[model samples]
Target: GVLPLAGLGAWVAGAGPVVLPLVIACFGLVAWGLHRRRARADCGETKIHKEGVKP
Candidate 1:
């Protein structure tokens, strides 16, 4: 979950060039998105139950 944030910190701290951290952050974002989707599905929150309401 903290991968992207850590990568951003690394980049800001000058740990390496911007390219590498950006690549890592991109991958981290994808991974976090997948994880969040799976979690939402597990919680039965993948769809809206009605107008102005979420499930």
Candidate 2:
């Protein structure tokens, strides 16, 4: 949230025009990766439970 806000502020402040977009893109990619990782972890847990694994 801070990073995104910084990016927006920088753009509004007229700091390079490319800065905001790049920051947004990077933030999005990171968020997406994290989400995918969480989904995979959940799936793995479900599979383990289905297999009757004691954990």
Task: Evaluate all candidate structures by whole-model CA lDDT and list the values in order.
Answer: 0.76, 0.85
Tens digits of per-residue lDDT for model 2, 5-42: 89768665696665767877988999999999999999
Segments of candidate 1 deviating more than 4 angstroms: 1-16, 45-55
**TM-score for each model:** 0.48, 0.66
Query: How well is each residue in 1-55 modelled by candidate 1, as lDDT tens digits?
Result: 8999897777767755757768779989999999999998866753544533743
lDDT, model 2: 0.85
lDDT of 1 at 47: 50
